[model samples]
Target: MDVKEGDVLNYDIVVVGGGPAGSTAARFAAKEGADVLVLEKRQEIGSPVRCAEGVSLSWLEELEIDNIDSSTSRTMKGAILYSPAGNKLKITERLAGDEVGVVLERDRFDKDMARLAVKEGADFMVKTSAVGLIKEDGVVKGVEARYLGKKFEVRADLVIGADGFESQVGRWAGIYDSLKPKDIMTCFQYRLTGVNMDPDFTHFYMGSSAPGGYVWAFPKDENTANVGLGLQFSRLKGEKTPKDYLDEFIENHDDYKDGEAVDMVAGAVAVTHPPEKAIAPGIILVGDASRVVDSMTGGGIVNSLKQGKIAGEFAAEAVREGKFDEEFLQKYEKRWRDELENKLWRNYMAKETAMQLDDITFDKIIDALSNIELETVTIGAILEGVKKKYPELVEEFQNMI
Candidate 1:
């Protein structure tokens, strides 16, 4: 429906933001016969691309995304990790963590996700922004939204906040806190053409070159790749930015120095552990709004899709049971946490521990791992290998083991 000024709309569930999380929530909820609506602030479902477009394929079957291959740009076999001192460690795609496996054409991927929701009977309005929450005696009841230049109200039995990192929907409901500097990664990226590199493996460079974060090159094609880096907010100096570091790295690399940048993107990612609470009466926060991005890799696609499915199904159940209270919503909270909390917490701690390592220690750790033939790659297994070669280096990571 076209929303005009003074329009008052209603739905069983309203999802704010139309990225993977919001779309997934809408798709699942509408599939269950809920009257669902999604409002995206941007003029299109996905534009002004802000991601490196890397994702792990292992979760696709679980997410039930049937046409993922149409949006995939390249398939990665594994990833090569380079330490500051030039030590290299290669890990297979299955063990390379969540960010490696396939590179996506994110704009197309996001649109495809939203299309799935619409196909399931979810109504979506692009250029619609949720400006505030509507509350009834301290419980969220709906949202005050602006569509194009017209303002309106959308009342719903439940509201899902799937807004991105700087989400305001969760804050308006008083369930989200601002991220600390140490927990934020300011990022920048470029799609470069004519890059000479292996297309089969994703590349990562660690150390002082990208303090507290790392540099990545995810191939989009045989000659094009997304070259990017994230700089930990706390480690950033007044003048040097993520772009500066990225530019230096590219200039120093023989393969990338001659490449031409055809596209550029900049954004911030929350690298904190998931929030203690993401639920309030009639409202649930998912994706970056709830800080569910992996603290170690700054990846959120898989986690967002998982949380969205959980929230959508629960929202549908809430409408059927006539239960929109906080107590009723606790089930959604518990299920998502049970599915993701342990790994998120572990990754958060690992990121914290990694930030303390110097170049020498990083090299020692990577070099040690490179020398071993591990049948399985895991935190405990990697630590065990490092412990055999350099016992002192594994001390700090003992807790993670």
Candidate 2:
């Protein structure tokens, strides 16, 4: 149904933001027979792409997204981690944190998700922005929005806030969505051609240069790739921007310097604690809206997709049972946390520990890991190796793994 000004358009579930999480939630909710609607503020569902687009194959299989091959740009075998001193530590495809998989055309991937939702009977309105929460007697019941240039209202039994990292919906619903400077990664990336590099493995460089985070080179093809860097906000000194560090990194690396820059992208990743409360009466937050991105890796696609699936199904159940209170919406939070919260929290702690280490400690840690020979790299294996060589460095991380 087309929205009109002054109309309180109704849906069983209204999802704000048509990104992966929102679309996935909408799709699943619709599959469960709920009247679902998705509102995307952007004129296009996935324009102005802002991701490196590397995703693990295992999770895609779990999600049963069979058409991923069509959108994949390159197949990655593993990642090569480079320390500040240029020491290389390779985590093979068998490693737990390897992230061996495909680099997607992110815009295509997001559009595909929206298509899935529409196919599942969810109505999506691009150019529709949720400006505020529709609260009925202190309970979130829908959203006050602007479609194109017209003001409108969307009323629903439940509201799923899958908005992006800078989510206003979650804040409007009174969810604690704040992040400290130390917990935010200011990132910048560029697409480059005329690059000479291995097409199989994604590359990561870590140390003070990208303080509290890392620089990445995710390949799109033999001649093209998304080269990027992320630095914790607290680590930034003077007027130095993420771009300044990235430029320095490119200048230092032969491969990056040789490449011709084509396009650039920038964004911030919340590498912080996930909100303890991601639910309110008739409202649920998923994806970055709930800060599900990993603090250590800055990876969120798999986690976001997982949360979206759970949120969608749970939203449907809530609508079915006519239970749109905080008590009922709390299940979505529990299910997603049960699946990912431990890893997310542990990784956040690990990132904090890593941020405190100097370049020499980072070099030692990389050297220690390189000494270990294993078929598959697990957190336990890596930590045990580090403990054997540098027991002092592993002390803070002992409880985390």
Candidate 3:
């Protein structure tokens, strides 16, 4: 059932969710001469963005992405890692480059990605929510989306689900869309005004203070910053919600004692790796939709860029070759999963194991991390430390290693 030219309903690819992944895919696909349409459920491009806004310079280099003109808030030589006892480990950022990763204005960055996509001929339909998959004989052939209050059908040879953590496309495409309890981290963030935070290296504090996760303050300016806390959802059963923990943190910390919040954002970051299957007949998933975000850092910019490029190229290739079968379109999955799946899954496993430890274990673990060569710290080393000092902690973590 090849679509002939002149069908207003037809396109080479239809991408759902116009975030980083969607836009990236659309950009590259359109660059490669495919007809691409991007659907965004939101009215604005980067409003309500949920991110810590930190990315390694290596990420930019790896993707060969040029940095757009943006103001420099701060430059860091490295990160300052803190222990429960308030011990500090100053790790250098040389691994990335002479310059550590910059805390980007994520909204502007997103708009740039979208702009590039649009310039590459990606059409956009904001306020458009994809309602269901348009299936033709069990083969995914496009989608049914709601725009402004009307239903529309779009037919394409390939469909990409770049939707966020709560992705419906993956579920509709027959993939396991449910997140494991251990694979989700709850986050609460604020843009605090009047806080005197050092606009240098990002700070990472760990302990029962933020059990199963950490707290960070990414300086947006001298008097304002994006400060946030994250704790694995499982860690909050008998403890505070992420928002409550953040309040406690701000109340206790001297720098933010009287900080006034200018903005607040709450969300979840998927710690899971890419789904086992990245594609089905005529369909693919990328970014949070594919669970490609980092479990530890909760960062998705780099991974999203990689996944988007792969999806776009592969979608065009699949459509051109007329190989809409799952086997043929599964290359994107293989590429992304190969590049990051191991790291993401391993981090998730270690996080789950680490989350079970009580306060004392966490304190001791931090102490070990504090004195060790922090820059090269690996999960295996931590696991060994737990086994040696707190032998009882080994049982819960043996499966993880």
Best by TM-score: 1
lDDT of 3 at 208: 69
**Superposed Cα RMSD, model 3:** 4.1
TM-score ranking from best to worst?
1, 2, 3
Model 1, 280-316: lDDT tens digits are 8888998888889998888899899998998888889
In angstroms, the error of model 3 at 16 is 0.6
Native-to-model Cα distance after best TM-score fit, residue 331 in candidate 2, in Å: 1.6
Backbone N/Cα/C clashes per model = 0, 0, 0
Which candidate number maximizes lDDT?
1
lDDT of 2 by residue, 173-201 (tens): 77884688899999999998877667788
For model 2, which pairs clash?
A: none
Comparing 1 and 3 on lDDT, the stronger one: 1
Against the reference, the lDDT scores of all candidates come to: 0.89, 0.86, 0.77
Where is model 1 more than 4 Å wrong at Cα?
93-100
lDDT of 3 by residue, 1-401 (tens): 22222333678899999888999999989988899999888987777768778776665555546764462345556677666666665656653344366777777777878898988888888888888988877888898877777777788888899988888888898776678766788899998889876667677777766767889888777777788987877667865688889999889888876889988989998776557787878888888888888776788877888888888888778867888887777677787777778877877766656666666666676565555553344566556755666666677767654
- As a whole number from 0 to 100, the lDDT of residue 68 in candidate 3 is 48
